[model samples]
Target: MQKFLFELNRNADFQSRYLSDRRDAMNGFDLSDEERHALAEPDIGLLFHLGVNGQILMHFAAFHEIEWQDYLQQMRDGIAAHGPVREGVYAVTGYEGVDAHSSRLSKTSDAEKGS
Candidate 1:
């Protein structure tokens, strides 16, 4: 996962290369089929749930033209739909109990109120 993210960040031509030929772009990586599918789908939620680092994930989100807020929301939605973060930096003990939709609504309301 880190290798894939690194390539996406370090290679100037990676996006074009990936878009043009995914199999070729991914040829040398040691990713599992599931990981490869996540990348292909650019499923930010699943990627986060799979324990991708935030720094790496942030860049990946940018690569997909997703804004920061949406990126965060996607992570939350991932938890809501797929359960807690599985590992890595974002893992937590009680995420399964979190009410993601209500949390999102609260945050949106707070933002609207200039808070």
Candidate 2:
């Protein structure tokens, strides 16, 4: 799926096919049903949750005419709806997620320490 996005970003002909018919543009790719659905349905948020690189996903969103702010919000909404990225560079290890991370920061802040 990542490769497909990269190709779609680089190739004008492929971009045309995607604009005309997303399923057909995706013909040769061995994408999972979730991947295919996200692409075909043009779900920007779902794709983010599926772990697509932002650089590649940004181009894909542009093809769909999604505005920049909307694209960023969709990715944020995807994380809220589907949890953190399931894979890719954004995936964190054992550390807790955003809420916990923020709480930890507050706990150690100078204000919280009365400094």
Candidate 3:
């Protein structure tokens, strides 16, 4: 997905192809059904929960003409509806959430130092 977004951002030919036929543009990539659905549906929120980088996603949203505030709200809504990111560095472990993972790592580090 990141690759697709990156290409969409940088590759004019791909961008033109995507603007013309989204499904066709997506044909070459190994996107999962969910990813394809989100792209096809243009679900910004779901894409966020899928762990698409925000910087990359912003372009996707912009390409779709999504307003900036609306894009932010969609991400928040995705978190509310989907719990946390499901992939990438932001992925939640057991739904503890992204920040919780950092806290867990911190606590583990502190415990190790104490020992």
Q: Which numbered prediction scores highest in TM-score against the true structure?
A: 2
Q: Which stretches of candidate 3 lie over 4 Å from their true place?
A: 92-115
Give the 10-residue window scoring lowest on summed lDDT in candidate 1. 92-101
Q: What lDDT would candidate 3 get against the real structure?
A: 0.85
User: Which has the greatest lDDT?
Assistant: 2
Task: Please give, for residues 1-97, the per-residue lDDT of candidate 1 as tens digits.
Answer: 7778878877879978988877668878998887888888888988888888889999988988999899999987877778877887666543443
Ranking by lDDT: 2, 3, 1
Q: Candidate 1, which segments miss by more than 4 Å at Cα?
A: 92-115
Residue pairs in clash, model 2: none
Q: lDDT at 29 for candidate 2?
A: 93
TM-score of each predicted structure versus truth: 0.74, 0.81, 0.76
lDDT of each model, Cα atoms only?
0.81, 0.87, 0.85
Model 2 lDDT tens row, 12-114: 9988888888898999899999999998988898998988989999988988889999999898888889888888877756324567889888888957679
Candidate number with the higher lDDT (2 or 3): 2
